[model samples]
Target: MTVTDTAPRALRTPRADRSNGQWKVDGRAALNGTEEFKAEDNGINVRERIETIYARDGFDSIPDSDLHGRFRWWGLYTQRKPGIDGGRTAQLEPHELEDRYFMMRIRSDGAALTPEALRVLGSISTDFARGTADITDRQNIQYHWIEIENVPEIWRRLESVGLETTTACGDTTRGFLGSPVAGVAADEIIDPTPVICEIKRRWLGNPELTNLPRKFKTAVTGHPSLDVVHEINDIALVGVVHPALGPGYDLWVGGSLSTTPRLSERIGVFVTQEQAPDVWHGVVRIFRDYGYRRLRNKARLKFLLADWGTERFREVLESEYLGYRLPDGPPPAPAVGPGDHVGVHPQKDGRYYVGAAPLVGRVGGATLAGLADLIEQVGADAARLTAFQKVVVLGVPEEGLEAFVDGLESLGLTARPSLFRRSTMACTGIEFCKLAIVDTKDSAVSVIADLERRLADLEPLLDRPIELNLNGCPNSCARIQTADIGLKGQIITVGSGSGTGSGGVQVPGFQVHLGGGLAGTGRDAGELGRTVRGLKVPATEVADYVERVVRRYAAERTPGQSFAQWVARADEEALQ
Candidate 1:
């Protein structure tokens, strides 16, 4: 007995009239609003069914209604190459798609992991995922090449270690993100571990929240550095202090980035550390009830927030949900940097936390297993996944620092990497993602390698960090909008219609964004990158263009000028 077996599938909102016996939910979105569609009609309560029925029956056993939609509720996405042989992905119909191997996203809320959990993740990746594993910016590990038959066993292994794929995708409370150094950071205002655990405990499998108009993302962090990316989540409980209330959270609502990017706005309400979970529950309830259910793209809480604004939204949360008025609270500290959290930094305790920079978040199962072993060997209790796709090993004693560093180096993870390597980020691109139009990971790696070789002599000039982010599509999966060097995918014809050597060639390319950064006085802050008009880089020439830009910055920067500052004062021509 599940939603599929009992809920009123024919029910429609009172405001809407039925058409052709289907609930035609109306839209408020101007872009893609007119067309009516039913999100729930896609499927109902398929998570457990996937394990109990679909996995046992094989891929063909899944009805079309489930394959394209219900499958995602359990964190399964068909990792198909939608656009074969260089055609536009969007132009193709569903029937034209190729391949059925799935991608499984394992939610790791708060970047929290135990060595035992790591071992489970690693073994699963190796045995079932074709050695494929990636640590996402959301503090999750995604595996490509997952098969239908193996999902049940994967769930068993994962659940044995206290991990789950539930609500990791598909319009539910997708997942929660917390500070990687939540309990361990020296300057943390509060530890978010308890809150993260509380959210999952209360809401993870609650059917009331399982169906939503679209995805909902939430982050809770008390770290002073704002390490959990409060501004980009639908609902973020950022650590703040109310003068009378002492330590609590400031609620932020509706922040998200995709084709339409909006920073989450602070709701001016202070929620007690204990009340944070309730506030979260209430806000999600609000999203579920009143959020746009028409257009899938407009279904995010951001759209609802946009139309309602925080004033009314807050009123509803107070009057209907929390049953108490939240008091005004101070804003969280402005981000000091891009919040990379890389390298060795001291914790409140005497021990040090070393953030190891992986190669743009790509690590094999063997590598992850080795990391787990190193954590045990080095006397560290846990490892954290940072927002920028890096690992921060916690509780390493001062005496064990040397051992930890050596072990990380042996694992191809380094305590200190090149500035580019540490800050570089890329999305899972055309290699696995269906929406992607270009290759991101391989191109990013090549660019980083080329830059490292060419800029060997320029290291002295890079007194501060620079971020290079690559996204396979305009969806901003790599946080491309805020990158110092943002590369968004597209197809471009690079010359006259009759030519040689990349001329008149329609190939994968990236739109160039320069000087984008989180802002600060000399070397810190947050700001979106400026787009260079008429500038796009072919995939093959990404390295060359990036090298030229960095070289120019090195040669021309004024005294004490950071990359962001240099780009601020630099002419657009000079940047290009």
Candidate 2:
């Protein structure tokens, strides 16, 4: 009923005892000693105890072949129900596995056609009989609802495409994320594509670093804008132009979002173009060594940074980087162009790149195939997908821009930038994810449609964008905290009074929160507003209330003012 702020418990370290030859003790008994004989015996006993526990819990590893049948092998799995079988809905299970999904990333080098890769994808689709492939936000392709029986065959097929599923999941480093418009953007400070490739080459499938305390994420931005939500990544290298170092980046470390969301702390070290890889490795090593593993919830790099303050974290990183001398790099210079890659823009080569809007980040199978065809026709100098759920078709010659734009229009995809659509995002919700409590995608679409209909009278209100984010659960995958209008699903009590023997109570529809924002230049988006009980007002009515608030307080704001600023300036009680 209420969003409670539960403080985390403090970490406790075991105390050491010096009474008996530098022995370790818990309470008052001898725990371990420096004696060689006792230490060997202790190690044997510990290993035996661990093996016993693993056996009792059935936590041993399962072969890749039996991944599907052994549903509980990984502690959790996914599958489909009979008759509910095709489409994305079949993938959604509240708390059970029907099938398993595996993902792989491949680099195509902007070539016209990779028949081998296409063959592999098609073969996997056939082998699984039910698996569907979708491209991810990070320019990687994911094959979902894969049957366990086809794991080996799928791997073989992927191998033909220069792809592998070995390090895609678990605690290993994921696919490196770079600006999709890497070399194609007109105003790029540096092309991060090669950088990402180098990082992946150095880290992927490395057994020595495969087992980590938690999964790690990293992003390199060629654009000044944090288009990849770089600040939320475990490691972020953002390109900035410094007068002294020419073009370089500032390294951000230990940032993540989950139940405990924290902004990354800057290390104050500017990485030169040549030293980025070395700096990245040093940060990962620090996290691997110092990250807490015993406490699963507190195992993230952010928690480690919290334990050791930013200064201390940097000191350890510096110690790690002692041998790898970096070139002299200076602070970033001011950005020259707009940060967003959403509209059509000219490339450095005098070509145009069209940013196509993919509503809700969903494109039909036919549409996806069509996009691939278009890319083939346009030449894949680069194709980028922004964090805002839009795709960019880069490096089309200026002469062909008109034709390419027409082709996009023919496909029902447009380059027109709408403030509402630009600022909206929703997770897959009930459509695919099991943890979703509400149909967030549908709800978001409906709310946006209604807002458009009601706000038709208020034209020229598109100067400033107002983010409206909806998440089905508190996981915040949609980044609800950075929105002007943030709506998180919550069950409210529909009826009051004692429950009758025959009568039943109604389930509450949704709980809405407003004005949560990320910290930076536009940091203050205020806190949660009032809990709008669904029983008294329908969900549709809630939309109307939001419209009224937007129209009242944000109708005639100053040039640079946002809806969030309006909310902050208004009297809290009146708004509530």
Q: Pick by lDDT: which candidate is best?
A: 1
| Candidate number with greatest TM-score | 1
Superposed model 2: Cα runs more than 4 Å off = 1-143, 151-166, 321-340, 378-380, 410-412, 495-513, 516-546, 573-576
What TM-score against the true fold does each predicted structure earn? 0.90, 0.75
Candidate 1 per-residue lDDT, tens place, 79-111, comes to 865447334677776645546779999988875
List candidate 1 segments past 4 Å from native.
Answer: 1-44, 81-86, 336-338, 497-503, 518-525
In model 2, which range of ten residues has the least summed lDDT?
20-29
State in Å the error of residue 106, model 1: 0.3
The digit string of per-residue lDDT tens for model 2 on 7-105 reads: 224333312232322111112232222123222332112223323442244323433222322222121234333233222333554334232342223
lDDT for each candidate structure: 0.78, 0.55
Q: Clash pairs of candidate 2?
A: 77-97, 78-97, 78-98, 78-99, 79-97, 79-98, 79-99, 80-98, 241-333
